[model samples]
Target: MLKIAMFTLAAAVTASVLAPTAHAAHSRIQFLAPSGNIGCQLGATPDGSGFAWCKADEHGWVTPQSDACPRANVPGAIGEPGGENLQLAEGQAPCFGFVMSQLFFDGQYAPPTLGYGEKRSVGSITCSVERAGVTCSDSKSGKYFQVSREAYKLG
Candidate 1:
């Protein structure tokens, strides 16, 4: 009985020591440009594609409560729906709107470009860029949305 109690205590101590480390690893945040208003947490999709989700804060500070993109019905390897794609020029910033935003490159001196269908996870919901526009669909949900760069101005 004494041996069993000591083993149980040791196991509990081991778990307590490792619990915070595991949680911290999972909550690691990928920092984007500190000067930019948008911050993204990046990872891989189930199909081995890059994935990321971003939030925008006007003050260039990112927090958990910042506005993020709509959650995808299907998630990537890291369990997110979006990826990074919009490249911005130097001195440029993100332009966010209802459930969408424009992305910029880290350094350059050109106009920012819209990241339409640039980042996506492969699953029930799939997205692609075509001549007509950026198209996405969730087969399970039977939902679809599109964006046209020609119809909108970049930030």
Candidate 2:
């Protein structure tokens, strides 16, 4: 009975020490720019690689029509749906994406604002919400994507 009690205590202590660290490392990453124009998400892939993504509420720019986008007659698609969202994957060039849908939730369902000048990092990728726009990049690849109402850039 004494040996069992000591083992149980040891297990409990070990779990307490490691629980917080595990949650911190794998917490979900999702937020929006304070401008209310951009939403971003940083997360891990099935292979454990990280990627960053952001989308604009409105933009002056247009993406080249791809068959995948099809100038859809759908909501949240606006004009050219394919290019409204930008993505930067680990060690890969930034690219435009077709959001496919634009359904949005109201009130508490909406993600919290990242606020201008705020930055978040997940592994090697870092993203910043700025007055100019939202920018996300990969340190190892030196690749980034920035987007706003007026323009966007990939490098």
TM-scores, all candidates, are: 0.28, 0.70
lDDT of 2 by residue, 49-72 (tens): 777778887778885444443332
Best by lDDT: 2
lDDT of 2 at 41: 75
Evaluate all candidate structures by whole-model CA lDDT and list the values in order: 0.38, 0.73
Model 1 spans with C-alpha error above 4 angstroms = 1-102, 106-120, 150-155
TM-score result, candidate 1: 0.28
Q: Candidate 2: misplaced stretches above 4 Å?
A: 1-27, 66-83, 99-104
How many clashes in each candidate? Answer: 8, 0
Q: Which residue pairs of candidate 1 clash?
A: 45-77, 46-77, 52-82, 87-104, 87-105, 88-104, 88-105, 90-108
Q: Number of clashes in model 2?
A: 0
Lowest-lDDT window of 10 residues in candidate 1? 87-96
Evaluate residue 8 in candidate 1 and report its C-alpha lDDT on the 0 to 100 scale: 100
- Error in Å for residue 4 of model 2: 16
